[model samples]
Target: MKIYVMVDIEGISGVYCSEQVTPASGRFAEGRKYMTEDINACVAGLRDAGVDEIIVHDCHGGSYSLNWADVSPEADGYICGTIGDSRYVDIDDCDGLILLGYHAMAGTAGAVLEHTYSSKRIQNMYINDVLVGETAVDAAIAGEHGVPVIMVSGDDKLCAEAKRFLPDVVTAQVKKGLSTQGAVLLPPEKAHRLIHDKAMEAVKKLPLIKPYVIPAPITHKIELMERCQLPNAAGKPYMNVIDGRAYSVAADSVEEARMRSGG
Candidate 1:
């Protein structure tokens, strides 16, 4: 079986503060090590499960977040650079997709490092009137091609978010968020073991998990963090201004809506 793994930095094991996830911060190097090791743990589990192909996508921040030298050699391929371009992986043929190190969406109370696609510009996002984070959007994109999101790993809030949206998606909670930046964390050793075991469990439960499909003719709404962004959004041909800080776009595909609205 082929598996695609999508990674983000904020929810990575051993990561707790904003500085650790920020590339410019001196503490970010420590977070990078944690990110790579967590990915390796997942890769090891998938390899042991007899998966033939494992593709890892560095979906966090311009795709330059991963520690390339430390990534497991067992992984078949690595996707890097700016996301949503030609370099993005084609998940159409993958049997399952794993969302690793993802956080809850913006406005999620008690979610560590919570934010949707953009922390600075975006305040909230919704699809078909349901609030969603990156997890749902990415899963919906994969679902369009019939691939199910089998597993997710992060803090308790993120795990809860995954379970609420995907239902059957296996989740590994490595930390418990007390606030946006504070969390009761698990040691790296324990976190890795959890991720490793969860990867195997997710693969085993693949038959019962279904792709997260959003209804067609989807309406995507974006609420900006500030009203200043409204003028810029109103000029976009694809955008329909809902109010001073919000805009909506109608599209048949999630990808199109995201691309058109710059979500």
Candidate 2:
């Protein structure tokens, strides 16, 4: 079976502070180790399940969190740099996707480093009138192509969020957030073990997991954090920039919404 794994940094095991997630931050090196190890563990687990192809994607900021040295030789390929480029992924042929090191939506309490895409710009996002974070949005993107999000790993709140939308998704909570910037962390080894095991479970229960689909002609409403970013929110074909800080995006698929909303 083919599996796609996308990993972010804020929700990785042993991450609790913003400094760890940013490339410019002093602790960023530590964050990279955790992020890379977690993915390797997931990859190893998928291999044990008889997975033939694993495509890795660096879903975090600018895709700088991972490097060639971090990737496993078992991986079929890896996608780095800016996301939303379909050219890098064979989404059409993929069987399932795995999300690792994800956090909750902006303003989620007790969520480790919660934010939807951009913490500097987006304040809230409504999908078909339902509040959601990047996880849901990304899932909807894969779901549009008939690929179900089978496994996820993150903090306690993010795990809850994933379960809320993807009831059958296997999740491993690597940490628990005390505040947006604080969390009760888990040892890297322990977190990796959980991620590996859950990934195996997802593959085993593949038939039980369903795509977390959203209705077509979807409408997205975005609330911005900074008024200065209004110009950046310029409208798209089906998306309209409203009230400077709010944008109304109408798209047939999640990738379209992501493109229009610049998420």
Candidate 3:
């Protein structure tokens, strides 16, 4: 079966500092390696579970953190860049989705790197009136095509949040949030073991977990940091300026919402 993997950095094992998440920062190289290791572990686990084809999307900052060449050649995958590609989790064609290194929603308590899109620009984000993070949005998109989010790995807070959103999916808590920009990390080896085990288990129980779908008439609300940027950013038709910092959009589906957000 084909499994789609979406990898983010904030929730990766041993990642507890903002310096690790940014490319300009010195620790970013190590963070990138750590992220890749987690993805590889998931791939290895899925392969062990008899999954033949896997497509991985590097969905972190600018969407180009993971080194595509470094990914295991055994399971060929694609890397999603910042230019806005259409190949993100084609749920209609995939058997399951694995959200790796996901984080909590914006403004959540005890969440590491608690921000939707940008810690500075985006104060909050809502999909179908439910406040959600990137993980939630990706899950909703996967659900639109009847693909179950079989597994998710991130911080403890994010794992708990994922359970609330995808109750039946398997989750691996690689770290615990000590602050918005810091966390208590689990060793890389331990994190990989947990991810591998959980991923394998998720595949076995994939049929038990239901796809998470946002009801029809999807609504999006983005709370921007700059009030002036709001009007210029979301000037598309059907997008209403809720206030200086908030803008709302009504769409028929997640795809429409994504387009509205310039995704």
| Arranged by lDDT, best first | 1, 2, 3
Q: Over all chains combined, what TM-score does candidate 1 have?
A: 0.96
Q: Candidates' lDDT values, in order? A: 0.89, 0.86, 0.83
Tens digits of per-residue lDDT, candidate 2, 1-263, equal 89999889888898889899989988899888888888889999999988999999987878878857967888888888865555237787989999989999899988988998899988999998899898898898899888999998999999999999999899999888899889888877788888888889999998888888898878988998877766453334676778867877888876777776665
TM-score top scorer: 1
| Candidate 1 lDDT over residue span 26-85, tens digit each | 998998899999999999999887889999999888788889998999999999886554
Flag regions of model 2 displaced more than 4 Å.
Answer: 83-88, 232-237
lDDT: worst 10-residue window of model 2: 230-239
Residue 120 in model 1: shift from native, Å?
A: 0.7
Instruction: Name the better of 1 and 2 by lDDT.
Output: 1
TM-score of each: 0.96, 0.94, 0.94
Badly placed stretches (over 4 Å) of model 3 are 82-89, 233-235
TM-score of 2: 0.94
Please tell me which predicted candidate would have the highest lDDT against the true structure.
1
- What is the Cα-based lDDT of residue 37 in candidate 2? 87
Q: How many clashes show up per model?
A: 0, 0, 1
Please give the lDDT score at residue 257 for candidate 3: 84
Clashes of 2: 0
